[model samples]
Target: MSPLPGIVGALLVLGGCMVGLRLLQRRYHPHPELVRKLMHLCVGATALSFPLLFHDPQPVWWICGVAIAFMLALKYVSPLRALLGGVLDSVDRFSLGDVYFLAGVAVLFTVSGGGLTFTIPMLVLTFADALAALIGVGYGRLRYPAADGVKSLEGSVAFLTVAFVSAHVPLLLSGATGRAESLVIALLIGILVMLLEAISWQGLDNLFIPLGTFVVLNGHLDRPLELLLFHLAAAVTLTALVLLLRRRLGLEGSALLGAAFVAYLCLTLGGWPWLFAPAALLAGYALLAHRSRLPGDIHALVALTSPGLFWLLLAVYGRRPELYYPFTLSFAAQLACAAALALPADPDGRVRPGPLAARVGLAWALVFVPYAVLLGAGGLVPALHGLCVTAVAALLCLALRRARRLSFELQTTLAATASLFGLAPLGA
Candidate 1:
């Protein structure tokens, strides 16, 4: 009838599930997977039903708070660990799956206040990912390696297919007769979510998949065709790069896919003139990998850092030339320099500073030369500022190469980010 009663009822439901899990642990002992999935199903179902059942967010927030607290207690307090028994036996010792699960639900619950943003992504995770797990475990034959372990190609296909259908079918049926935009958004979101899961370190896909889906819906739903074309370009670039990488190393399919995705985003999303750097880096690495005969692995720090800067730019300034220019240009220079330093010179992963400068110079010329012509001499100061900042970042990366807390990856990320701020004045 009121918020108080609704809170009570929701808590009771949560407590009931906990007690049920505890009883299952005692009775079944080793059937922890069943208990785990049962909890997952109940949690998701409860969250999805919240906005429908209650009229306000107070009860929903309160329930999520309790769930979060319970998960934290289970993790830190020794006795609570017995609740899940062995369902998490295969997970890493430091795995945050439980916490992330509750967090995902809480986030989606809040997003549900706005409508389909929550409903579609939750269904995709609860239905698609789960189906993929079931199918992959029993029938999956063609497999690839992951941070957690090997996953089946068939299983991933299942995930993508289910996610696609769950995410888009409602749009088509929801009286959007003249507009195909929603379908495009669904495809972009589904593929991105699927790839993000494939490369998710440890088990963090729980967080990324849900959150990423929300971003696509919130940011690009109105511009579905543009988003679709952007992602398609990403797919095309990623595919072409994979073919080139094949001639060099026996890299995993996911790695190739992620690289392509990153390459395309870096090259396509920002300013047209600024993209040449990512393209050059992609070409250089593809060639180097082939020539050097070394195995290629997509480092998370590098992969995340490259795209992350782009996201930061978009989030902060979108496509505004004045602000976006400095950030994008500095990012390009940082990566170009880093690529020079990090490029495969030999089998030992050593840097050839002389060659590094040459490569960086070439990449810079390809990017800024065209930029300067288009914008006239006005682009000169910003271009110089960007180069100086990147050179400085290159040195920082070298100095911090052995820092225990700041890995080369972390240093580059920080340096690249800082360069944007440092050079923003020039663009402004």
Candidate 2:
């Protein structure tokens, strides 16, 4: 009665087909090397599926743990040769989709309480990746690469189609009907997943794809009008800021100012707790703007900002369903500001500080400060604390410009001290 048996059986059948194909390629087709490689891939996939079939504790653990150990061993040993024959490249050379597949299975086991709706979207990534590769290699012609010339439009379309269809499977199984709704949801999810894959360079989409699918599927988007307006306003403001900065100030100054503006907006919006990201943006500008430095300072700023800010925004507004739109708007505004400041501009532009600073300050005012006021008056003292915290952060940043090697201990102390004052006694 358990779906686990059926799932495992499906995986095994797929793997067996792959193995059979490899055998045919080796015996009749005479492509021994390709056959060996395919065989290894099939073996790995089949071994991974074993846990899905037998849902006992030991078998599941052995399937996962042993499979991982086997992969690791293959990285050192010639796994392809061991499985079939002939030396093959390291497993690292292959996309780590197997890991994602395993992770999805783990997620399914852990969150089975949420029903099939929860586990269904994850399959989209697996199906999409394989389907895209298959289609692209066979029929790809139209290419579209963001930076490197490795991506193609054919691949994108294939990925989107497969992911979209795969995303609908669980929904259909769970009783979602009406051909129109299913098609629309599938299309939306597919597009989003493809987009994430296209932009992701560091293979982060393995995690982001499934997670994003889950959010979009479960989360409500009731304020489309507000979201659209907020995005438009943010985009316009960012464009104006970039154009003004480029015309009035040199690229370097604009970069610094733009980074600062974005940082301020993020802090004000309550997304990030510190100003370090903005500072890093500034430092990046400093390096690119100056010919003398390697921009080691950017790392320092990133290190300071990442931890404190990473969870701040999500913690503050993630649960407040009503405030989601406003928070999304503020977050979008910050990103827009950052992108605007990062645009490439002509070198002949003059550097003017006055207008640029004012624009940055204006953005902070329109987006973050007003939101803070709304949150503060609503008895959210943390908003007030956030402002005080950011002010101290600003001062610390000014200090860091003079001394980059400020110790981690000192930084922690400073952050703690600022936090204490920021959260000063309510009456005080």
Candidate 3:
């Protein structure tokens, strides 16, 4: 298989996409969404053909770089922006979807461990997501705006259905998913993807659907019943928390999901015996949230999402508890700092970065030092990981204050990305 053919195919698709989008823009000036979806469909379809086009990973990288470069070019280049209405004309201040799309594609090519992993993310994105966009607008009714989006129950269910079938079909054909595996794991992945999609706004689904689907598929729940029960319990309890706190705290549905998922993942990975620290700590925070009147800001989000993400990654990938708990404790300390920073300081309600750092240092000393001492050297990497997360989250909040609004959800989510270990692994 000559690589030249695949490379040529990719180039042609890229050129055609630019030209086609221009044609569409001239013809359908008012239909920005149509133009956008068309772009999504074309790019996704092109990504789907990668395996057929390139026998090796090198060309995939070349294609990815070229595509990303082109997207970036579109952003800065005036004529190109005019031609495509700047990547689908979403309300987001920036084209996050373009970055997400390319990242998802690159992730699939680089990280997929063959078999089901290679195909599932691509299939759902290429087919299920595209289908959902079309079906959601056409057939959707009984809309819920805040919890999900302008999405209706019918459309959400439609996405789940297609996602589930898309997941099962390729694996079934390739003999990667057996009957039992398909019954539970595949179904769960589909449902999870749908839940994420429901919460997704501004085509963030381009990122979450593919990457999240990949993670869930890779987690490989061996004792499905146990995790299922745990997930259910956590989801229910956290949702109840959302109901209780939403009006007062201004928490979003995604925040509720963050609480729920970490509750499950934390307890599951740590097992029944290891639930004490998180349980006690969170309960204490609940009180602080009440008495302190914590603002539902991005700082609070960073507080929750840290533990949530670390627990999730730790459970999924951290096979050994000895080494990971230190990292977990470090994040715990950071969470405490995040919680404190969520409140106003001194007589004034303003938060200063200097005092915030001092408080964070104190919190880390109070929590991480003791926990790390208890755990010994096993906690080193986890502690470093946790410290770095807190530092970066704080710095980013400080740095981008003028540019981006520091919402709780985005802050917490940014912290959570740290927990994902940068899409690598939990390591030394």
Candidate 2 per-residue lDDT over residues 286-403, each given as its tens digit: 3332332212322333333443344346545564323322232323233223322333323533223444344334433433454455446553444444443444443453354335
TM-score of each: 0.78, 0.53, 0.67
Evaluate all candidate structures by whole-model CA lDDT and list the values in order: 0.62, 0.45, 0.61
Runs with alpha carbons beyond 4 Å of true place in candidate 3 = 85-87, 90-93, 133-156, 198-204, 221-250, 273-288, 291-299, 311-320, 323-428
Tell me, by lDDT, which candidate is best: 1
Q: Which stretches of candidate 2 lie over 4 Å from their true place?
A: 1-61, 78-95, 113-115, 135-150, 177-181, 199-204, 211-360, 376-428
Better of 2 and 3 by lDDT: 3
**lDDT of model 3 at position 74:** 71
Query: Mind giving the per-residue lDDT tens digits that candidate 3 earns over 233-334?
Result: 554565466557555554444544444444545555655434434443444345433443434432354465465455546645756554345444434543
lDDT tens digits by residue: candidate 1, 1-428: 67777677777887788787677667767344445656666766666676667766667777778877877776667776665434443333456665676677677667657367777777776777677766777688998876656778888888888888987886677644225676676676677778777766555777777787787666665664765676656655665766576655455756666665565555545545445545544454444323433234546524434544554456446545455455445445545545554555455444677876776665566555655676688877766666666566655565455343445456556655754564356434
Root-mean-square deviation per candidate? 4.5, 9.6, 8.0
Which parts of model 1 have CA positions greater than 4 angstroms off? 18-35, 83-93, 112-114, 176-179, 224-255, 263-274, 287-320, 328-357, 373-376, 384-407, 410-428
Which lDDT value does model 1 have at 150?
Answer: 72
Instruction: Order the candidate numbers by TM-score, best to worst.
Output: 1, 3, 2
Residue 250's lDDT within candidate 2 is: 32
Worst 10 residues of 2 by lDDT: 289-298
